[model samples]
Target: MKYVVGLLLALACLQAQATEEQTVVLISIDGFRHDYIELHGAPNIAKIAEQGVRSEGLIPVYPSKTFPNHISIVTGQYPSNHGIVDNNFYDTERKQRYKMGDGVKDSTWLTTLPIWNLAEFQGVKAATFFWPESEARINGRTPSYYFNYSTPAPNRQRIDQIVEWLKLPEAARPRLVTGYFSIVDTMGHRFGPESHQVAKAVKHVDELIGELWQRIHDETEVPVNLILVSDHGMSQITAKDMIDVKELNIDEELFEIVNASTRLMIYPKEDVSADQIQQLEQRLKQKQGNFVIESEQQLAQLGVTDGPRKPAIVLGTTAPATFTTRPEEQRKDGGTHGFHSSRDMDGLFVAAGPAIQQGTQINRFSNIHIYPFMAKLLELELMTEIDGDAEVLTPIIR
Candidate 1:
């Protein structure tokens, strides 16, 4: 019995040492279409794909928007469960509005545990650089180190900071680090997805990634696992593709537009009569002929009805199209996401590290599963039960 106990102790020590030797870095490139890699010559990213695990695409959760999808990826829950349903949403229950820039001012909005919180609880130090919601101490626990979203910080500076963190003593070092790049999404929004500007942004981001890859290899003694992801892909749009809500000529006083993008959501005015709300819903559907007006059942099917913040009516446009409440404010030509996660709207995911399988290709997978992957890589216990099925990634990660 003593001999067996001694062997178990020896194995546990080796396991802990192994955990300390590995690092996991998750990088999110906003609006990085799965095909951007194929369209652009991103040698560093391609090299990682060639040598490590590569997914054909990462399918985002419904509404396929930024904050919702990014939050979903970390929390291992759908936007409905995680409580960030859109870039901007009106919380009907709280009578408050939640915007992307709201920061972590209200912890009550989120209902799930992000990976950083899990890491800290399990005695693993973690850090984040501009990852959505990283700044807020949700559930009264934030990452060990995090930076607010700063626009002026250069990509090189951000990478340097991460490298410095990695170089810290084991006790002080963070095993998990997350970084974000929004330039690609910015260019894709200003220009179209196929525009030269987006291409340029992609190349620039790739160069920054290459620099980060090299720095990690040169600067850190620990073996690092790099996981690259994007919230959702961008789709081209034009004036012709937009469905203008004003064209409907409905009484604006009867209802309120909660948020509008490719995905449209609206709420009836609090004092509005049920008959008035019914009329507004019909008018919206008639005006936006191309959009699918979602009923409560359909909203549930699309994973949008489970939250209190869900609007009274939801509009989902077919691809290459958008619905806008403020048509006057809409740009003439550019790109947008927030579409169903299919084909061109699917995002990107690639992993390269000592432990990741080589040249493996996952045809497609959901982004929510990423939380489980992070948990396993960091050797942290997932204290909260999450919706992500971590086993889906076991094949590639091993």
Candidate 2:
């Protein structure tokens, strides 16, 4: 018995040492379509694959929008659990609306434990550089360090900042870090995915990533694990696919769309009116034509269901098109996501580091499942195994 006890203590000490040696860096590239890396535009991303694990696609959480999916990546929970149903949604119960902006100020609204919070509990320090909802502390606790969404800040600046943060003193250093790049998604919104504009954005972000990586490899003493991921994939759009919400007499009471093109938040005026809500869904179907209409309940079962604050129904722009809203001008012409997690909505995920497997593809896994992959990479204990199901990515780890 003493021998067994001694072995257990030895293993515990070894485990703690292993955790201390690990470092994880998460790079979230927005609107990173699965093809971006393979399309010859994102060479840096391709290089990451050469060095580590690559996936055919990283399925996004349901709703397949920015806020919901991005939140899912850190919390390991679906929108239903993390509470960001869409970029913006009206809470049927709260009788209030929640946008990605001020909606997440209260950390308690989130049911699942975020990766940063979990890392804190384990004595690991974590940081977020421009990740969504990172601007403020939740439950009066924030990451070891954080940078809010400074949209106008240049990408180079953001990259430099992250590189600089990694070089902080040992006491100030973070064991895990997450960063964001929104140019691709921003460009996708301005021009369709196939447009030359998007190609340029992809190239630009790729270079930014390359610069950021050179610094990480050159500066950091401890080897770091990097995860390059995206919240959702992008879809091409044309002026033809644009929807004129004014034409539908949309219920500002029923639906409030923040992201406009990729996703929508639907609410019915005057408490749970079934007939009106059905009509609203039908109206959207007529206007958009062939888009998938997902009620809150259906979305939950699909693995990306949102919280109580979400609207009545969510729609996916399914055609070989996109979504946009403009009143006076063309009233159209933009790309978007927020579609279902089908082949059309496939996103990006790539892992490169000491532990990652090289020259291979991970099966279709959602961003929520990224937690297990990250936990394994950085060697951290999950807050609780209940956020979502994610494989530990043994394929990448030797």
83: Cα error in model 2, Å? 0.4
C-alpha lDDT values of all predictions: 0.83, 0.73
For model 2, where is the 10-residue window of minimal lDDT?
254-263
Q: Could you say which candidate leads in TM-score? A: 1
| Model 2 Cα lDDT, one tens digit per residue, 63-149 | 788888888898888777777766766666666766676634665555666788778777888888888887556656678888767
Report the Cα RMSD per candidate.
5.1, 6.0
lDDT of 1 by residue, 311-359 (tens): 7777778766776655466447788888776777899999988767889
How many clashes show up per model? 0, 5
Candidate 1: which stretches are off by over 4 Å?
1-21, 325-330
Task: Indicate the residue-level lDDT of 128 in model 1.
Answer: 95
